[model samples]
Every structure is written in structure tokens, then in C-alpha cells.
Target: MNKFVDYFKIGPVFTYFIRVFRKPDPNAPTSQNLRMMHGINRISIVMFLFCLIVMIVRACTR
Candidate 1:
């Protein structure tokens, strides 16, 4: 939806993270880069949270 797109439309935090972790096309504009970078960040964040939960459960059991 338009609202969702507008919400995550390349803010300062996204820009910095993309600059460091994602090799976005320099020629491409921010809007195009935003969608791609958002996907990449979502996947990485999910994986990080999943791993953190697993570690915590493991430590508690041991």
C-alpha cells in the first residue's frame, strides 16, 4: 500500500545501514534502493533475533 511504502521510504537509519551492509547501486535513486535495502535488513534482523532467542533458551536449559 501507499502508506506502507511511504512509511519506510529511505530514512536516515536505513541509509546508514544500507551504506554499510548493502551494496546498493550508486546510479539508482533512493526509492529503488529503499525496497531492496528494506528486504535485506528485514531478513538479517529476523535471523539475528532467531539466533538470539535460541542462544537464550540454550543457556537457560544448560
Candidate 2:
């Protein structure tokens, strides 16, 4: 969707790494970045789970 593309400009994998160590910036003018930061973090969690499942399946089959 165009909305998704507009908001999440960063690719899923890169966003995952960036989200890992981000602390909230309280001094910022608005909470828009805060919301996006949380979104990236959520995306990272999902990606991590998907990768873990794939790794587990590959290990099982080998």
C-alpha cells in the first residue's frame, strides 16, 4: 500500500537493526518520531521471530 511505503521508508531488515538500540528522545518537538520508533521496533520483533522459525526448520531437516 502507498501508505505503508510512505511511512516505512526503511527496508524491514535495516529497520530491525536500527530499532535495536534506539532510546526515546524526549526533547524532540513532537511524538511522531516516537511512534515511528516503536513501529520499527515492532517490525523488528516480527522479523526476528520469522527468522528464528526458518532457522529452526532448516536445522530440523538437516
Q: Model 1 TM-score?
A: 0.50
lDDT (10s digit) by residue, model 2, range 15-53? 657655676566856577768877877787779889999
Model 2 spans with C-alpha error above 4 angstroms: 1-30
**Inter-residue clash pairs, candidate 2:** none
lDDT of 1: 0.76
Q: What is the Cα-based lDDT of residue 12 in candidate 2? A: 71
TM-score, cand. 2 vs. native: 0.51
Tens-digit lDDT track of model 1 for 1-62: 99999987778765665565656577877686778777787788779879999999999999
Using all chains and alpha carbons, the TM-scores for the candidates as numbered come to 0.50, 0.51
